[model samples]
Target: MRQVIPLGTVTMTYPGPVREQPLAIELHNTLYAADGEPLDGLADERGLRAWLGAVRGRLPAQARGADPRRLADVRRLRDAVREVLHAATEQRPPRPSAVRAVNDASRRCPSSPQLGAARGGGMRAAIDHHGADATDIALGAFAVDAIDLVTGARRGALGRCGAPGCVLMFLRDHPRRAWCSPACGNRARQARHYRRTHP
Candidate 1:
């Protein structure tokens, strides 16, 4: 049987001082890619927790305080993100509930880096014109980006871990961040070994 270690301490990364800030589109896609993973039931919820941990690591500034209400928002956004990603992959339109959640989170969580950038003057209009298809996941990304922007790390270091079958999040503090932990890295290596031997 394969071993699955408990996820360990994850390091967060942010960008350095930048002459040009990360573009809104860049932030949107980056966060979406980091948070979206094809998984089993409630994968979205699991992925959302992983994404939030990344946000906590890259926080530009501490939230004024923990608002328990935000936990509810996270749950809401998690569901919306799942619906949106599934719809996009299936080539369907985002449901009204998903759209509303996106809009609400984007508007309410300006602290998120992705949403803050997407809120750039012309961005909302573009989303409106597109009927909110692609922008569904962008809402949660925006909130996370806002948090990233507040942290000094917004400049260059942001990214997702490259580990396969492990939808963990991490900052690019080092050149290599393909896994959230050495354990995941090892698991991936072992899985590759089995594949090579069996196949």
Candidate 2:
């Protein structure tokens, strides 16, 4: 028997666990939407600052000067990541320009490996970055993660939400997982039901 469910109000902002996503993927998803009524999370300096604050220790340091140019750069990187993810989902190579963008950002603020002694006498591999500002470090980290995601085996799990007018992407860990979130799944089902009944 098919269970009937009610559709709740759709919020203007994305409601998902940000921490659960890889930092680069999270950055790519910063823009809450992609269709006609998209929501920009980093629309201004204040928004950028808020996003940086939320990421906190995951990034190198607090951004010193919040400006439009910085926000633009971040948005550019995010777009490049999106491009790469989109290509990966389509099983095709990403654009050379997009690859270059991610590579350039990563090179500008490369992360160094640090060997540290563990509590019981083992060695631990830690990441140490140099000579880059907070924003650059953040971009580099995102680029590195993006490269890993698009190039690694997990790339096969990449999927875009099937819900109508939705442009969200996600890693499909389960065989039956088609939507990016439960809400999107519900919305898709509701749409299917409406079309069936109306037709």
Candidate 3:
């Protein structure tokens, strides 16, 4: 049976859009499962372009001018990010190649922050890309975010969705957040209930 969750006025399926997570986690979640089959959110050049536009706010690089030819680069970076995150969550060593890939991407195009006094007493900042284009800067920013997420303060909060057949990774933003979303939580509860009654 398919799991359907009705939250107040709207009804949602078992797997829903996994959002509000960090950029790197979102990248890792590009490969997710639906109805027993894996779906790549970045399966094509057009899809990649759309995904980049969706996350433009969080990325240092602008999305509108991204080259369609950079789709392969994004896919490779996402794969490497997923590999490292899997290893981190499992408390094992990641593949050396994965580590190298992330590092290389992080250094692909470096940016420097320029800070100055704001209107009052605070400070304002802007990024200086040093002539690099949008695509390279975006890739480097994504890799840098992955590095910080896996090795920084919130590293302990990295986790995978526990709902059955779900392969999305999420950062533990809430203390009691076990699944990636409310839909997943409801599905898990429904599964447990089914097992208790059917067995």
TM-score of each: 0.37, 0.81, 0.86
Worst 10 residues of 2 by lDDT: 1-10
Clashing pairs in 2: none
Q: Kindly report which residue stretches of model 3 are placed more than 4 angstroms away from their true locations once superposed.
A: 1-18, 61-64
The 10 consecutive residues of candidate 1 with the worst lDDT sum are 16-25
lDDT of each: 0.42, 0.72, 0.79
Regions of model 1 farther than 4 Å from truth: 1-62, 82-96, 109-165, 169-182
| Model 2 CA lDDT for position 180 | 79
- Which parts of model 2 are misplaced by more than 4 Å? 1-19, 34-36, 60-69
Q: Which digits, one per residue and each the tens of the lDDT, describe model 1 over residues 9-69? A: 6432332111122322122322322223543221343443333333332223333122322
* Clashing residue pairs found in predicted model 3: none
lDDT of 3 at 17: 49
